[model samples]
Target: MREISLAEMPGLLGQEVGVSDWITVDQTMIDLFADATQDHQFIHVDPVRAAESPFGGTIAHGFLTLSLLSAMNFESIPKIREQTVGINYGFDRIRFVSPVRSGSRVRGRFTLADCRFRGAGMLMTTYDVAVEIENERKPALTASWITIVQFDPKDRPEGV
Candidate 1:
């Protein structure tokens, strides 16, 4: 991942931050996610059944796609220097626009939508993220994801 000084964060507002490397969503990965999440939905875990459905074959669960953001971020997004920890704050909005078929390659494109001081030593960052399905016209999902990053108090600027 790219590392940038915390001081440079404010300058990144509304900028396209990064694009992650492609990851293939195969049946094995889909089945494991279903099992872990206890979803066991046919469209996600049953290829034969899913093949006859509207998607034409097994598709990854929407949440599974959503859950990949952190991995994708680690692969390409810029990190703040001296940030000790980052926590998933939540999503302001999320939309599943297209199905990610099994064996499909997907990648995340992130934009630094907003940033704000949360407390004395924390910064809340929001990203506009799009999960693009390889060779597909429509993206699989789009979300406004937030993360709270903790930096050393000594690195924090004085005042707001």
Candidate 2:
């Protein structure tokens, strides 16, 4: 996990940073997410119903995919740098291209899209993230997310 500063603009743009985990999209995991988010649609939680549905099996929730973005900060990418804080700015674009059925392997691919000055000890960086399902031609999800990762020595974000 190589970490750098936001002031290190343009240089990191388009760079493909490798995340640390090899995640499995299991049925138990999907069910857990369903329970947590109150999204227990049959397609995601009921094996019998989902088996009869078009998907042929239980699938992960789209929000579950979106939720993985926040999980990435802790699970996959480590803020190995000495930065004081990293804050979520927002999303530039987000799309759930394909279904992530239970019993699959997925990994995140990150491409730095834009990094610009956001003033007063902050830099806004846009990253294109793809959740690739193992052995699948199409990705499970695609998103462009923004983060203002700060290397400020004076103060840290309130929550951090």
lDDT of 1 by residue, 1-160 (tens): 5689777888999899999999999999999999999999999998899999999999999999998888999989987787999999999999999999999999999999998887778999999999999999999999999999998888986655
The residue pairs that clash in candidate 1, if any, are: none
Candidate 2 per-residue lDDT over residues 1-160, each given as its tens digit? 5555343445667787656365787999898998898888899999998999989999989888777767765566535254667789888788999999899877787777887655556666788899888899999889988988666644323322
Give each prediction's root-mean-square deviation over alpha carbons. 1.1, 4.4
In candidate 2, list every pair of residues with a backbone clash.
none
Count clashing residue pairs per candidate: 0, 0
Instruction: Report, for every candidate in turn, its global Cα lDDT versus the true structure.
Output: 0.92, 0.75
Runs in model 1 lying further than 4 Å from the true structure: 158-160
